[model samples]
Target: MQLSLSDKFHSEMARLCPAPLPSVLAIMVSGGSDSLALMMLAHDWAAEMRQDPDNGPVTLIAITVDHGLRPESAAEAEGVAKIAHDLGVDHVTLQWKWDGVGNLQAAARAARYSLVQEWRRRKRPEIGAILVGHTRDDQAETFLMRLSRGSGVEGLSAMKALPLSHKAADAAGAAPVIRPILWASRADLRAALQARGMGWVDDPSNDNEDYLRVRTRKAMRDLAKIGLDVDTLTRTADHMARASVALWARAADVARDVVTEPYPGILRFDLTRLERIEEETQLRLLAHGVGCLTQAPYRPRLSSLEALAEAAYAGRGATLQGVQSFVQDDALILVRELRAVADYECPADGASAWDGRWRIKGRRLGEAVIRPLGAQSLAALELPKGLPKTAFQSYPALWAGQALVAVPYLAREGLCAPQYDPSAEFHRSILSH
Candidate 1:
């Protein structure tokens, strides 16, 4: 069954943005057929979606990232910009400045998303999501890349249709990224573009076999001879994505049942409940708990996590992934390592992210370093009522030029909340797979 361009476009947009579309949306156009096609389709789809009573007016814009790695990059960005202009959509070309280069692809991707996000924060804060053109071919390539690296199901799931964060910023707040065109094939997009009398610029780097993606692209052609084509790989990735979701759901359920925050910056999982779940889910639950405490972007390596799980299963204690874990009284206690936790500069007023785990807000606290209540602070001062001495060192405290001024969660002096929520962060991790 063949679907028209409009049909595919509308279906993708419907799945990605069902109702209540943002007042403004963005498409990343890299002068590629897939991205250009996405820009064209999204422009029309946004207009159509806006007509619904439940949805509002959507101003679609195109963004071109010029990495400046190659001489033709600027021209390619201009080419995309020209198309965006012809399509009656606003366009902006952002440049990536680099003094020296290593891992060009990764650097470019990070810079591109960072630039786009910065633009959104400055010009269109209403833009909640940015649409990226990641066709099925890209997904297949990603799957192969991860597979070659011995990745697990989560990694094999490849690029998801939506990610909570683009991983563009190290900070707690980052705009969501959506791959609305993942269901479409590159051929379909190019054919649609051709039908519309549109052309695209081919990046030379894509043909450079030195790159993993280029090599994988060529390898996929050979694999297609044996029926291991893009369709097959993409189907495998889709299945893995579903499996990943179920696994995450199970882990989240386990977390809800057993995980408890006995004190600020501390997570305790019931050993009985932890031992009951399957080993895989147990690892996931523990990893997620640690991730929430440390606010690290990625989980510990599966092998490392497995070792930690083994120790936990045996009622033993071990620390991994910036979290210190120990067993005490039928509970697996996990706390952020005071030595490992990064200190964040406290803000004067309003909310500021501390160690990417907690948000602190107060007045006249700017210039202070928010850190864990370490041995020195715990030894020198008195804690609030009902605060246990065992948990005293784990609490977050403000240190201003060696003066311990405030401990928010423990007292009325300041306000603090864990930035990472168990259920929310768990679902976010699944979505990003």
Candidate 2:
């Protein structure tokens, strides 16, 4: 198993990308066993790709993000840089100091990704994806963690090869976070590292019981006695992932037929056609609507979402995940909840986004702001022709002091405005959540 590491790496990358590109490959190496193994395998893979006359040249770059939580982090990063140098790979060390924020582990992970992505965008914009060292053990631990939280099918599903494409602003130069070693086990990776007489930095936090991941790792051995091993849990995740894909396809089909966007940030579905779909499909559509409207990273809780669905489908008003729902003339209408944006006022300076639902670009005015058109603001002006009042209350409006300057939704003729349509993005994000 140890000697087969290079073969496994080559096979996995070949399966994922049959036609290789000449772009740079940024490998995240934390001086740990898993990442060090990835670094070694990626070096060999890049060398092989370069040696091939038919294939374009491949560049391998190693990135070490020093979280600076421990005193030895900097020296460990330096060691990894030395190893990458010996292998003829370019290496960069990025320092990330925690601001004492929520969940040290989560913050560190987010910061590392952000720093590496920014570096790649500024220095190596041609790179399309960044590689990571997630293994089968990590997948099982993730499944167990989600199960502890009563996660549904989407949450329990196996992690995707490309996970960042589901986001709304993917148009930005952010590359997809790729995990090529998901097929490999942690033990095999460590054993391979030892076989090469290589030493890896072992972070003591892995044994710290304070972390849920560490605790889960400990429990895996005990659970294996009852046949609930890492392979079994990982397989369970694969099964759920299959089901998730089928459900997403069904929901996407329903959305293409019954969903329409007549106004910015508003979703109108044919009530009769929507009612004809299955309950699960309906809920999935509802989740998509709220996600598109709010641009929130996660979906609403299933129990609360079920209640909100019950009310909205019954023609009663309801709100969930910062999205409001209503029934009007045999159409189910979804809009941003007024309270969600009531106090969300940002300076009308340069180009910016509001509520993550609209992209704003207009003449910058001093002391002007972008905010929602509240009931008072809407009552003061003539409503747009054929526009529903429910959507009117949440329209993105430009204000200078107490004067209402412009409403982007109604300013289509002007050069300044925002485009919000669920019809285009609805289906792509169905399975992503």
TM-score, every prediction: 0.85, 0.85
Q: Each prediction's Cα lDDT score?
A: 0.75, 0.80
Give the Å error, residue 365, model 2. Answer: 10
Candidate 1, clashing residue pairs? none
Clashing pairs in 2: none
Q: Output the worst ten-in-a-row residue range by lDDT, candidate 1.
A: 415-424
Cα misplacement distance, residue 164 of candidate 1 (Å): 9.7
- Model 2 residue 409 distance off true place after TM-score fit, in angstroms: 4.5
**Over 4 Å off in model 1, which ranges?**
47-55, 99-102, 163-172, 271-276, 310-319, 327-330, 363-369, 381-394, 399-401, 411-433
